[model samples]
Target chain A: MSEASTPTPQEDERIKETSALRQALIRPELGGIVGTIAVFTFFLLTAFNSGMFNAAGVLNWSTVSAQFMIIAVGACLLMIAGEFDLSVGSMIGFSGMSIALLSVTFSWPVWLAIIVTFAVCIAIGALNGFIVVRTGLPSFIVTLAFLFILRGFTIYLPQTLERKTIIGGVSDVAQGDWLAGLFGGKILGGLFTWMGNAGLIGVFERGTRAGDPVVDGIPMLIVWAIVLVIFGHVLLTKTKFGNWIFAAGGDAQAARYAGVPVNRVKILMFMFTAFCATVFATCQVMEFGSAGADRGLLKEFEAIIAVVIGGALLTGGYGSVLGAALGALIFGVVQQGLFFAGVESSLFRVFLGVILLFAVILNTYIRRLITGER
Target chain B: MTARSTHAPIIQMKDIQKHFGSVIALAGVSVDIFPGECHCLLGDNGAGKSTFIKTMSGVHKPTHGEIIFEGQPMNFEDPRDSIAAGIATVYQDLAMIPLMSVSRNFFMGNEPTKTVAGFPFYDKEYAARVTMEEMSRMGINLRGPDQAVGTLSGGERQTVAIARAVHFGAKVLILDEPTSALGVRQTSNVLATIDKVRKQDIAVVFITHNVRHAMAVGDRFTVLNRGKTLGTAQRGQITPEELQDLMAGGQELATLEGSLGGTV
Candidate 1:
């Protein structure tokens, strides 16, 4: 026993290295990592000469990715809990329209309008959850119903209130509002200005009246996306509630048999999905200073596609938040990479389809290899 | 009948009857499960065995019966209530999430949490350690607690379920046809696990149709035929052949076999 206990240092190191390799191979994010690297490398090879690696290029793609990631992360969680919310796209439009109408038309405080929008969105989210649970209906069908209902309202509400299909001048009301600065606008503006002055970053030709270089600051959307991803990763991997989400999604009957409150977990997932949609809507409305009924059209499918590429099973009970974030990054790179490479923007959909298919196949194959399933 | 124990049973059922609509699943069945003993319920298909166990496990309420648990009359509202009352049922399917890790499946709804900075998180390390220790105690050495339950062998999974129930402080472990789908080696492993659980002073209600299996580990046997108790006997009082005969409706089987032999 004493002789066996005193293993050689080389042997110990060998065992540790092999186990670490095995652990890496079995990780859920392995597919996402591969997909991200493959897509990034493809873009780097094809669009390098077109300024695709420049700061402006990075900002453009990152902004788009941040928007997708916000909802994708929520969709990832909800999917992990064994449900879907198709109305998330419409919820985004509806939330943005509500915030705009409340703050602009009613002359309410911007902060209060945001709060009211969140409350309304959350309530609708809860209703979706409640109906799905009580009626034992598939969330896909229920949320599909909400998808049309919300889209209809988003379009009809503005036309009814102001005889316009779009709500404009949202940024006008948001001006001078401290809360608006928190949710919208650029962060680290001073640092970017300094960088431009020091010739570290490229300055825009259109300078301000004060003659300061117009180097763009990091968008709050990107900040929120990063924060949400980290928060989601921690919640799913470190908390008891995370375990419940997995169990609920894996098998509701089995989870219930083990004493998990499956109903509550699913309901909260629905509410969280809605909350994420509202956050996306608020950021977009504040940034663009306008809201239209078609602002976030087809975003639900995009988010779901992002989640699928992230290695989450559509049937539920298995996923990774970091993987979803990486999936969003891949989307951003491809969509903008195509533009930089002079590929037709209409071909973006084709790229999205091919990437999604490849990701799903790779993910399934990897999972089978890990589980040793035939 | 061999001498019945004078000590009170952990769970006592009197005139238990269950009906699903017009179908009489179980009619007036009574049984007593004592701690530290392996009581085998032997029956054929449609013998009301599933309904009886479901009633005991709180999946179904008895239409006409009284359940006395730990010297107090009780009616469990659901499986959760019975589980809270220390009666754990490991069904044939085992009620385990296949995709989840062993430790996660072991804790499931009753996870051990550690609060840090006013936020509670799953104590994953603790769960893994306890799961490893408990599974090894049941003679099933797991590769790792993080291994998914679906990856485990059928016998190993059953042992894990039994160990999980014991870890959660189950006084009465009702196994519903646990060995029906297992091979010979797996069945023996499960029987060994039952013996281990019995030694730990937990009352084991082993439901099976296999007479040889019952004779191997059972301290007492109760035969159910067509929703009624055929009889109860101590292990020594009845041989395996006699138990098999009784399970097949002794007199009726004998007469039919004799007639067939005569015609041949």
Candidate 2:
């Protein structure tokens, strides 16, 4: 009794204290955190004098990275719940075209168009989840079907109605619109101007807009990324629902036996993935001032890759949102850093394939350590 | 064990019958489970043991007869309803996620939370402390509450499942082949856990095909053949060999031996 209640150092020899290094190695985010540091260091050493760290250049990559971060957040959570959203890339194009058709061509208010677009996309996501659960089919095949269907609609709709694939003049239609501003507007303009006046930031020397800061303000894209990451991180780590996500992904039958509503948790995750895709679409449309049927092609794979690099196992049930966010950051840095370092941009695909393989190997090692599997 | 019969049974399944279309799984099986005693259900693979327990745990509603739980005829539509009524069944697989931490698995669906600034969050410290304390009470020393459950041995995982059921206020605990997959030492550990739980006055329905395991901890033993009960016996009234013979259908075996022209 004494030995059972009190785990003294002399008692229960099997209870060896895990070494700190071993503990760190067991964390799911270890690979992502390490990769983030390694990528940043590599870029710093190779592209230091190439203007990659300057405000303008920093924004350039940050904007690209933020786009990845938004979608990666959704994919990370869905993957943790033991599902995938192959339709996410197509969902983006479909939603963007919906917004453009409603506001620019159909003469609907931009705010109404944005709200309706989100609603439609979210419903489609829920349908994807519903079919997977009710039919007991793998989400891969189900969403794969939606991927082609939505993309086909995206191209077919514009060609049939507007006689063109790309719809422009959306920015003009969205001017002074409340919902559009949330996606397309910038913030902290006054602070950037003050910094420019104080010589803290570079100013245009002899352009038409001389004496203004080269980088005016932080775009809403970056802000949205930060907000979504914090939200996803908190939702995953600090809530009862978060625990359910892990359990559902780890073992769905076991989770159901434990009284968790596994079906509902999975469906909600699919909807969230669609919602993230829509956010990306809205931001892209507002930034480009146009929507093309070909927009967001293959972005689903990029989001999944970022999530995998963030240390999430492809098998699900284990991951970290902060890790996925850092993974997106690495992608943004490396993609733009190659251009700054005078490397062929096509080699970026090669880097992705190599990094994914490395991350998977590291994740498998971690899984074996956790499960003691051979 | 004699002292436990003085009070009424916590659960009484009277003439429960379950059928799957034309095939009858359980036909009029009755059992009484009392508090503070281990009731062992011994059966072969096709003896309808799984069907009987599923009916008791509300997985399948009995087609005939009724379940009188706590002296009232009750109906359970689903497993969740049975859980709400203080009946918890830990299956052979243990219903545990191998990758989740012990504390997280401990409170998988029913989590305790504390409100912080109008937002509720999972109370980790409370959960961890309770998990460690409850696990120690079962004589299984965990490294820590944060250790993944997959790292534990099979017996330890079974104990964790039992400990979780007890912590959540289970009045009747049903274990489905708790030691079927463990080594000899691990099997003894799970039997000891059953003993500990029975001491706490919780009715433990231990299901097993092993006669030696059942005799070690069972206060009352009920053997099932096909879909019918072969009567029940107290600890000292039945020998292990008789129990084993009853499980394997001794008459049928003897008839087969005779038909094959035994060497004797």
Candidate 3:
């Protein structure tokens, strides 16, 4: 009688209580962490005595990694929102040319030119999003169209106005320009000098500026990369909107049923992608002292590859900013490490393809484990 | 019935009709839903059950008739308007992202936030705590709030959706085929969840074609056939077989039986 009258409990035997170790294994950042360590160890072993760890060599790869980081953060967020922006590379070229045309050719204040360039580029980004949302077209197609249009305009606009695909004299016009300094100038020079005097780092042995540290203050590009990574990570993991992004990418119909503004989230992510591209373009033009029509060729693919290696699903709905940043670091290290180890630089592409395949396989296995699907 | 009949209905559907061009989906169906009562809407496939719920939940505007909600004549422009008016519909799909954690799915669009140094954070601790409490209240003791919704049983997922609606102040809950895809044990758990929801004084419109499942927790049963409600009957006044016959069309079944001959 007591057995028949026993009350039913809510807890079921089917739901497995996960352990802390198992939970950590399921994190999206696991592959990135392992890959970063593996890459660093490989480089350190092969390129240790080739001055690859020197101050200048470290900066070389870090700057390149920062470029990849800027665009990867944007791509990572957009992928999580269930969309793609293929126009990012062309946008870089277009934004640089626009900044040059406004500041140098038109003789506008460098600050105004930079601000106007940002506004115009961001508007174009918004237009990309608008077309995608209003027409219900895939963002891949819409942004692919913009990629050609922007690249064409980038090449055509300079040739039509100045009879050249590359614009020069931008650095001369930008000298003493306060806005230009933010992009091009380095910081912490005094600290570097102090380090040089204290013999903490290599110094100029027999140059006009002797006893100067080989590496000076950090570049604004790296600063911007760090800032954007922190911002993107915080926004993607700690805010209510982050949940909406996951929902929108995971199942858009479900998100809408729950009252999420999916279109708005997707559009904003596209705009953010454009914004990141423009930041990269501005820093490139400032550092190089000119803008070329083919400046950012294939950078969009590089950013997407970095994100993929960082463990984002190509189908969208799952990823991490920290993982993407680590993926960028691996790219930077391997690209520069190849040259340091006396290997052909072109082999970098081969490495990217191989690592990308491995990461995707790892991510797929993790996905299956999480979902319990065959 | 004595106490419930005295209380005015929370939602009154007066002669509601819906049409898809030449096809009439719901034809002049009227049902009054009282608070704390389980109103089971029983109907066979293509019998206007979906259309009727869609019209009631603001997914479609009726071609004719008015919806009186809380003594106010209401015309919901869309699902959002109905949701804002305290009507939450958990459709068959449950509108849940399988990859997300149970807490995340519980508060998908309506996440609770707490200001931290002037910045609003997603208050995950509070959300997790509340999700655990609410799930247990609905008779589902989840392993943890972080368990992915995909890993949960169908009945557990339904409980999560229902608990979410209740926590969000839903006055009337419309569940479309909540137990259709569940196993027998899971179906019983869901029916028990319905009972728990009703005890909270929230009106539940349990839509299903299964007579046995409907009879488990349903206080009143309304059967529809060919775009019209045959009738509404109170508990103890109707049996499971009667409800099944009404859903399958009593006269139509009799004629079908006669056509089959009396041997078997």
Those runs of model 2 whose alpha carbons end farther than 4 Å from true positions after fitting are A1-17, B253-264
The TM-score, computed over Cα atoms with residue i paired to residue i, of candidate 3 is 0.95
lDDT (Cα, tens digit) per residue for candidate 3, span B1-264:
769979999999999989899999988999999999999999999999999998999999999999999999999998989988999999777557877889999999999999999999898999899998887677676777887887777887888898898999999999999999999988988898899889999999999989888988999999999999999999999988678778888877657757877221
| Residue B234's lDDT in candidate 1 | 90
Please write out the lDDT profile of model 2 over residues A35-94, one tens digit for every residue. Answer: 989988998999999999999999999999999999999999999999999999999999
Q: Single out the weakest 10-residue window by summed lDDT for candidate 1 chain B.
A: B1-10
Instruction: Give one digit per residue, the lDDT tens place, for model 1 in A270-339.
Output: 9999999999999999898988989889999999999988889888998899999988988888888899
Q: In Å, what is the interface RMSD of model 2?
A: 2.6
- Model 1 TM: 0.93
Give one digit per residue, the lDDT tens place, for model 2 in B153-185. 888899999999999999999999999999998
Candidate DockQ scores, in order: 0.40, 0.58, 0.63
Q: By DockQ, is 1 or 2 better?
A: 2
Candidate 2: global Cα-lDDT?
A: 0.92
Best by lDDT: 2
Best by DockQ: 3
Question: Candidate 2 vs candidate 3: which has greater TM-score?
Answer: 2
Which of candidates 2 and 3 reaches a greater DockQ? 3
The 10-residue segment of model 1 chain A with minimum total lDDT is A7-16
Worst 10 residues of 3 chain B by lDDT: B255-264
In the order shown, what is each candidate's alpha-carbon RMSD?
4.3, 2.6, 2.3
